[model samples]
Target: MKKTPNFKMFMFLMVVFVNTSYSQDVVYSAIFKNVNKTAENLKHHLNTSGDTLYLESKFDLNRIEIIGTDGLKTFAINNITKDIRVPLNSLPMGDYTFAVVQTEGRDDTYIYTKTIVFKISRLLPIDMDISRGITPLNASIYLAGGTIPILDLAENKIITDFPAAMDLASMEDNKPVHLDYTSMESLVALQEKENLDAKHLRTKKIDNILERNKPAYSKAYNITDIRSGNQNIQSRADYRRNNLRPNGLPYD
Candidate 1:
């Protein structure tokens, strides 16, 4: 009636195995880029609040660390696939500087950092046209150092895409039209028709440096800007026609 020694050993082994299985750690990951500039406000949806953030370097696996306002904290992750996505839910609502070492085994490796300013608050109505350019309507829209342009309506309730400049040869067919600001039906329809043309792709391919350093990073493709050479002439024509729609008419 004495307890067997083999049974006691088996129970201890089972406890150790169960403890090891339950102590699984979560990994953090993100990729880095050498591109000169990127979109400032890259917002992401959050599932819950008060999440811990871990920063993993795409170039160096050993450089993974926890980034906080107080200082750096060491952490590990499974992989880093794209731009560094660290949770800022626990941090105060304000500007923050995220800094990390770019390479491992080298102390002189570049210190990469980005400044992000964000606020957790209600949204506001934005005037897209005024954000993009200035036209003959006595209002300004374009700003210095801005690559993209925005066009605003007469009432300024909504904004439109930059007007396409028409050539003199197309002057006969060109006229301004008012469109329903509630929906972007015309732009969407036009995009489906004239999108992905050979001309546009050819222009974009030549202007961007996507095929550099073959065999090293052969699969890597980079795009800075897309230049089609032709202005938005067709878009201007569509706008002019739509603007012609009267307050109550079908196509007015």
Candidate 2:
């Protein structure tokens, strides 16, 4: 017997709900912190074909615009800061200027822009050579870097960080710095010791099994895979049962 809700009342409630929803415009700023001051500009150029320009910055980004002699391209978003992925396949080979803009609280705004030059080219290979010897194995260091990469050819692994401590930009004449062979010798010795320990543990396990099964082997079981138990199905468990004792030498 109550009065039904009318269309006018429903419409009025919806209008109030939409107005009360939370929404705000994006605002942001950025600062460059790299120490290599000799590099003149904040922007860096890339020449890869059909690649994207990943612009990374800390700011509440509203829109980023790329301005070239051809025209202007704008990318807009609602975030405070975001990566602007600019595809370069469509543009002609040349230089361009990019502008990054951000807004805060609907009124505050800021902008950063820089000119970047880029060119397209074929990638070159790198080369390598033995740099120095610190030890027998670990110390033997190799250096490689050229327009053409140096193929290892021997181990089939790309050579990286020869001097170990030096960064790429700090290398003199783009030549790799190798570590000493003394380091290599120590590594080899450690490996040999580990192998010896494993052999010793294996011998002890076989001895223990023989002792336990000797009483049973002479009577019924032949020790030829007598099915020790289902628990021995796992390689690790089998290895332990065949090599270790309840009170034997610690495996490590």
Candidate 3:
């Protein structure tokens, strides 16, 4: 008597064969080889003058395209040399992919494409009011450091020079404030008025603050959580308990 073939084993083998065939079919473009080789020789340097992005390429480029991470093309140029300056004052801060394509060979069949990814960041200084209970005590202490030292917790190194903070106490209440070193002096002055100990002033690493506070910020500002009926009800209850007027009415 012949034994029946193992159906499960046969099915598994068939699946493996199909997957192998599919993987073989996924071939990279021919241009990618030249693109990779040229990319190895190319070097990119990025600098910012006000809102303009100055991109310097070491190797000559046939075409350069700036594509947003979302696959939207923001800028492009053809037959450009090494130095290219792009105005990005209006563009939002985000990651973008730069594609540099070049063609070589007498027949012009050789195509090469290279991609560089980068992010744009902006530092905007705003004035903020420091109301009691509005800002955390530790954060206030950090602000008091005036030229606060930002430590990289992972590397355990100070990144940059201490920035001077200005006292904008006369500004409108509840405005956003960008605290620098001078703010530390203001904080010290406030402490003196309250007769608080100078020893209470402390500095914290930026990484530590971000790591500790990220979860709270995420929870407080999560859109999905805010939209949930249960979360809204819970938030309302918390508000009623935490905010009460002199007449015993909950602050709306």
Candidate 4:
């Protein structure tokens, strides 16, 4: 038969496990990128409160100590590496301060970490070789001194050469370009001839309509004089109409 475990000891062990777990979210290293800014100039972030500060720094990889606060002394897991992630959900509920310290010897100096992390596994680009101590923080193109990013991420698709021909007459500026599809020598000449013929026919039709619609009247003249030859007589209306004058002919 097995003996029963101590209840008080079991509870104490549980508390220790919870606190240690919460303290593992913070994994840090000596920030080697970005311009150094003073504490007064740096932007600080907030915690969920009553959280235990479990900063895991380079495990003497870069050698630093931390979690010092205005009211608390934060601790770092000296065995933590550049690969371990800060488990945010495991953080303890507490008040703490964050600072950027210079950590070359043993003091934990935190600056702009210049760090970017992606948690998804196994689906990264094949050219992205962040294994055996390589990481995106040092391999991203957007960062200074970083290596070339994923081979496929270079956007080689749009580099294709599209063979295109451009015509000035088909383009638009402030003054629009109007295109005429009709061939000038053959088609335009035929069109012009057709228009002239149509106009002449229309004019003849109008003249016929006017002649039919006008009022009817008769013209006459009386013989007032006999010619010297006595073969023809002169009529006044006929004389005036038939004669040409300096001022021009009068209306009959």
Best model number under TM-score: 3
TM-score of 3: 0.28
Candidate 1, residues 73-160, lDDT tens digits: the string is 4433223322233333234432222333333234466544433322121111123223443121221212211222111112222122
Error of 4 at 104 (Å): 99
TM-score of each: 0.18, 0.24, 0.28, 0.17
Relative to the true structure, candidate 2 reaches a TM of 0.24
Report lDDT per candidate.
0.34, 0.40, 0.41, 0.33
Best by lDDT: 3
Candidate 1, run of 10 with poorest lDDT: 117-126
Better of 2 and 4 by lDDT: 2
Name the better of 2 and 3 by lDDT: 3
Off by over 4 Å in 1: 1-58, 61-69, 78-84, 104-252
lDDT of 2 at 123: 16
- Runs with alpha carbons beyond 4 Å of true place in candidate 3: 1-40, 48-50, 103-108, 121-252
Residue 248, candidate 3: alpha-carbon lDDT: 85
Q: Could you give candidate 3's per-residue lDDT for residues 1-252 as a string of tens digits?
A: 121255335434644643464323211100111234545545443221223344455554455455544465533343335544443333444434455543332345644555554333322111111222222111122322433232232233332445567777775777796889999999989978666443333334555677788744223332245365334233545646676767988777
Q: Write the per-residue lDDT of candidate 2 for residues 189-214, one digit (tens) a residue.
A: 99999999999999999999999887
Residue 94 error for model 3, in Å?
2.7
